[model samples]
Target: MRTSALREQRHPTLTPAAIGRAATLALHDELSLTPKPGLVTLIDRGSHDDMDAHTFMRSLFSLRRYFVQIAEAGLAGAEFDVLERFGIAAEARMRAATGGINTHRGAIFMLGLLCAAAGAVLREQDEAPRPADLQRALRRRWGDALAQRSQRTSTLPGGIAARRHGLRSASEEAALAFPVLFEAALPALSTALARGLTPQQARLDALFHIMAVLEDSNLAHRGGLAGLRFAQRTAQAFLDRGGVARPGGLQEAHAIAGEFVARRLSPGGAADTLAAACWITRVCGGS
Candidate 1:
């Protein structure tokens, strides 16, 4: 058995502020990752015409306090309704920071909940929780509430597109506790890392995995069902070609990025999930 000091050294006490900073840095890391098909990055504006990396950064800065507040709420055992109110205020702040552009809106919801879950888990444990533990905590604490929330129709573009295309809305994804993030993105990232891939390569692979499976309403909204199907097929093809494990995989991913841009298809929801995966990795001390 490990000594108390050693365990403490391994799992430092996670404060709400630290958790919030981790969430923000995870978003930054995702934005810094290159060649994400139909997503914004530091080098290219994938498929979005309204925002870039700088815009994402500004939104991240604006939402820092929101994450901290929600994390604190989780530590205090606040209800989901209260957390939703915080999220609503944060969304308004994000739009204000981005000049009415919807940068980081999806992230603010998903990552915000994840942050809160982390706080709740840490509060109940002597040591820091693992990624799986945090995920379980999220579902155990908020699954029922999330399901109830998902029952209501969404008025956002992604929700509207999902309804029209018969795809899962963002709320539905949350209600199911983000199976794509946990089952697809997280596992893909962990596998890539175990295979000795670089952080960037692993994250890229994870993003593609999410794109392959997630019915990203952003893609539906932008390119319609046809666009969503095309994006899914393209992502699946990349994974079949050995993802980041194969030789020339990075080049192929960049090529796909160009294609997605030409088609004006942006899988923003998948991109957000990729960031959430990164956040989980970091929170679980996998990074």
Candidate 2:
């Protein structure tokens, strides 16, 4: 059969490897973003004592193949259990690479689902899926499974914190198709870029926007619910002062980062959400 004919027959979309590359690149974008309150970067370890940029790079290397595998499975219409198995394996590889540090655990779940959904959407449309198309595919395909999964008790600190505080866990966020990513973070990113902000500035705005609203379980895990609320207020204050657009905005953000580090409060959930937003911008051709 001709290439066109073969493409029309089935799975007429991006390669799993290409999809994986997009996912990995998204994570890298998030990691490279500096002055992120309480998050790791190339220059410093934010609030974390165990991991740094090198550790994240190692985790990224370990999970590279896992994204490809999950994307391939989604291309084949594999069930949630299949994707879960891939995630489990990816987590193991990440732990081994980082000497048991949880550098990208939340990312593995959030971005992993996104990559799978991207594969499914690509196979269906024979093109890169838009944010809306991708979200619809994910919820239609695996919403129920994620919803069921969210009910189970979790031993992870974020999950435990979420349950204890009545905030949504990452699983719950997934079960609802990641409103913060699609609704908040992506829009903030697109708007910032559209308004002529530089790439780094736009991403910083998006990260703060997410932090301003998201019930980040990692924040709660670190400093309890009060800590999470403080982070939210701080981020909102930055945006209210014109984000990175005003003269002193960047300095203000840096100051906020210093405060976060001092407090030992890491907004890992918000970081993962930011990564997912980055992935959407890349995969869906968003500005």
Candidate 3:
């Protein structure tokens, strides 16, 4: 909507060269919205000239539309229910897949809620950090699930190291990526938020931006430990190289994400996405 201004102002961080490199990688990877054959490929052919801010914005939004589909589908009724409910059943499933009681749906839903909250802040222009709303919403839907006790299961096979190898199901992999995605995305969002956008809009905008970059590149498909590592490194590198154009955006998001990884992962800073998601769940509600 603010097309003219967006085009005129030179984004200090995102250089033409950096965006080009990222865009080139995105074009080659072509990770589509749907898991359906060639759907993403079909969508990939559209215009994505990162040279133009309008085009870049459009391209980013386009990717958001698609990733929302993928993210939605990656989580279906069962998985959705598990996360929304965040209870013993979800725990059981995780236990069955991994050897230990590694994660909680409560955590995932909480992350989702944080996304919802941040999305609301950025998009809605609502009041700032309504702890009551967050607590109430979480309690209303996921209260029992969170409260339901977990009967500590056996240790995970491969000592949690094997989980990162990418042999896990798509849903599991996504679960892993959730935290990492937030780690990489949230700080940029926060910086954007400080620039007069609401928290919700800022969060959604940042996520949309990342998804846009991913669409151009195919980061999601390369899902093993190495692949995830690459994604993390790339995100950090992009930030380090001043790709995110905002005052304090890159550093804040990175610090939050780093704290998350250190606290959650088995290794205390396992650079996995799921580990990042776990960390987001705890602090994303504006603590």
- Runs of candidate 1 with Cα error greater than 4 angstroms are 1-3
Which lDDT tens digits does candidate 3 get at residues 66-98?
222222322232223443443344344444443
Q: For candidate 1, which ten residues in a row score worst on lDDT? A: 126-135
Model with the higher lDDT, candidate 2 or 3: 2
TM-score of 1: 0.97
- lDDT by residue for model 2 (1-287), tens: 69878765443356788889988998999999989999999999999999999999999999999998998988899999999999999999999999999999998999999999988886777666789988998899999999999999999999999999999899999999999899999999999999999989999999999999999999999999889999999999889989998999999999999999999999999999999998888777664
* Segments of candidate 2 deviating more than 4 angstroms: 1-13
- Count of clashing pairs, candidate 3: 20
Per-candidate TM equals 0.97, 0.95, 0.30
Which ten residues in a row are the worst by lDDT in model 2?
6-15
What lDDT does the true structure give each of the candidates? 0.90, 0.91, 0.33
Candidate 2 local Cα displacement, residue 255, angstroms: 0.2
lDDT of 3 at 16: 21
Highest lDDT model number: 2
